[model samples]
Target: MAMDEIIPPPEVDLPRETEDSERIIPSPDVEYLPRQTEDTERKLPSPEVDYLSRQNEDILEQKEEHGKTTELERKEKQLKEERHGEEHERPHEELGQGTKLETQCEEHKRLERQCEELERQRRKLERQGEELKRMKTITIVYEQFRQWIEDKASNSSSGVSFIEFNPSEVDDSVPKDQNHCLGRGGYGIVYKAKLRNETVAMKILNESSRQGEREFKQEIAILKRIRHQNLITLRGACSEKFALMYELLPNGTLEDRLINEKQRESFSWEERVRVATSICTALVFLHNAKPNPIAHGDLKPGNILFDDENICKLSDFGISRLLQQTNDTGTPNHITEVPKGSGPYMDPEFKNTGKLTPQSDVFALGIILLQLVTGQSATGLRKHIVDKLEGKKLEKMDTRKQKMILEKLQILDAQLKLDDTSIQDAVKMVSLGLRCSNSERKRRPSLEIEVWPEIESMNKSECLYGSDEVD
Candidate 1:
């Protein structure tokens, strides 16, 4: 039954459904209207079916693109991880270098501080050492000086006629000379002698003569008491002979210098005035001396000398005397050699009274001033000059070299008379000298105030002597 049923209608051909369309059959018993020309009906597939197929293809492509993207992303992640590992390892290498730098910087800072501290300590130590050395030297010097003072104080007869023939440290190992006398005066002679490495003037006395011995002791006492720059330096002494060594002056006395024709060329007007100023300076120093004032009993050109530096120093102290507080108005500082000076420059009062004072020295210096200016010895000037009808020496003068000299002589004739007055020096210098040489001692000017200022003026404007004259 099953086979038969299966064969039936086996051959009945049915229209196959096509992919492009869906077919539908018409209703039965419909009017055969000329074999009902039902045109071959075709139905296209539905729009929904085409849309579904396009969507399926799009989904498949999306899946393939996603796989490729995932593969590429994984490869990128692996590469990044490898780079991160390398970067992580590099930090260790840099860390080692950084640690070394840090250690070096710390060490440098520590060393710098250490060096600075060491320098500070060194400076402190050096300063302390220097201070200690200075203290030790000062202590030793002070102790020695104190002991010397104490010894002097302890000796009762230390000062009174305590003629200590002390040797000079500078001349401790020197030999003395008997001859080679540099100068001779009433009291003594000055010998040029060697002392140690230096040349000195050794003033010796005739000790056999009683008068000379007395004077020698007096001079020694005076020299020991007085110390000044203007006075002669006392290197050492022997009180018995009244010998004293002095710093040697290369040049000789003012007298020897002024008169020597060849050497006189160097004695310019400035030098002459300078010499005069030095005399005044020495006089002032003596007059104002503390304890007792001193008077140079003899002030003369022969006693004044020039050093190697052409500096003036008062050489002869043999005639010098210390004047007490009372003004020695009655005495004169002239001619006697008993601490009394020379004749030509002596005050007339001194010719009678034998005493010394500041005024006495001033008077003598004034006379020397005249001798220096005239370049004529007192004997020559007296003989050459002549008084005329006008009662002045103008007629006797060959020419009027200066106006002050002529006028001064006229005035002196009216007062003291020209015959006795020695017309010497320039007009101004003569005037000053006359004032200094005044018989009335009180009328004399101070050495510093009166003499030095004028001498200084002349010194500053000095023209060579004879340059303005009839050379």
Candidate 2:
């Protein structure tokens, strides 16, 4: 059933190497009958064999192309791996750089902190150095002051006992001592304090004060030996920082009484006349002192003080000097340098000549007298006073003060027998002030010669009208 059905005959047969154009017909009865000749078999190959040869050639060519493609793929994969590795390494390098930058920033901040700490230390040290310098200066001044006092006390003929003062007792650092600062000037600061149940004024020279150390020593030397009722009494002294203690004048300065409305009422015209006279007497005592005559180089209302009793007293001898040598004629011995006095009270002749004399003091005293009567600033009204005395009307003077004094005199007239003497005395005193303040040095009157006696006479005339009575 199987062999005959399984094999099928070819539809067409191909022939090779036949030169004759002949056709061969096969009988269908036998189905498989043809036998190949040797020549034909040699020339023609079988179909399966031919197909296998072609397949082998195609397989060889495909294998060669595939090998070339595989090589290209391997090269591309290698390039990709290299690129990825480069990208990764680049980020790692950047991370390293970032770490280095952060470290640098932290180091800069540390340096800045260290610099600030050093600067603070430097400033603290500078302050400590300044304090040490101040303490050293105080020690030197105190030693000199103490030595001078001992010598003066031992040799003095006045039988005055010099009391040694402790610097710590009057030191401003003492919390119990209330230092109500009164005022400050070139000389130093003055403070009012209640010490030992007694009110007193303490002047303390600052380390940076404009007043010279020599001038402070000079003031101490002068005040320690000199004694006068008209001048301020020196209560005590502290060697530390050039501190001087005096009885407190609750009424403050003459300038204060003149300027302040409430305080000015306490000073009557008769009192001002008496004050001027007493101040002149003080000048006389200073000028005629034993051994060496002293000259008050600076005189102004600011340096004059009033007590609780309203008695005027001279103060601030910071620029006072004992005459180098006294002239026999009562004029203070001339010095080469211009006197150190307030500009308003400075004598013009003294400025021109650069010479200090008793006449210079006289000029300052006259200026003070003019201020007292006119109630105008010595500096501000210098030209006015000059003009008024030179044939100008009395109304042209400070009208406020003129009216005030005249009213006071009129009130006194109603209460007592104030005749022409009071008026004449006032006119004569004003005339004397003008003569004392004359521009020429020779024309200025000495307190001993002219100013003192005239003021004394005026005081005597004023006493008859009850000068002690407050208006």
State the displacement of the C-alpha of residue 305, model 1, in Å, after optimal TM-score superposition. Answer: 1.3
How many clashing residue pairs, candidate 2?
A: 0
TM-score of each model, in listed order: 0.50, 0.56
Best-matching candidate per lDDT: 2
lDDT for model 2, on a 0 to 1 scale? Answer: 0.68
Off by over 4 Å in 1: 1-179, 207-211, 327-339, 379-425, 461-471
lDDT of 1: 0.60
Candidate 1 worst ten-residue window by lDDT: 412-421
Q: Model 2: per-residue lDDT, tens digit, 1-471?
A: 223343565567556647653666454434443333343356567798789989998898889888888888998899999999999898999999999999999999999999999999889887676555434333322333344457656876523433446776676433444547877777787888655555678788877876867777787888888766567767777775577777777777888866776666556667777888767767766776668878788888888888887777788888888876655665556565645668878878778777777777888888777666656567756456555446634434454454445455331122222345555555555666777888888877656545665676677533312223311
> Which candidate leads in TM-score?
2
Clashes of each: 1, 0
Local distance difference test values of all predictions, in order = 0.60, 0.68
Q: Which digits, one per residue and each the tens of the lDDT, describe model 1 over residues 1-471?
A: 222332222343556778643555543334332233332112234467678878887888888788888888888888899889889988997899999999999999999999999999999987777555434333332343345457756987432232245445324423355456676666556677765455777776654433466566556667777654456666667654456767788788888866676566566555666787667756766675667777777677788887887877887676577666634543322334343457667755665655456788888887766555555464423223222113343324533433345555432222221221233334456556656876767787756555655554555444232233312
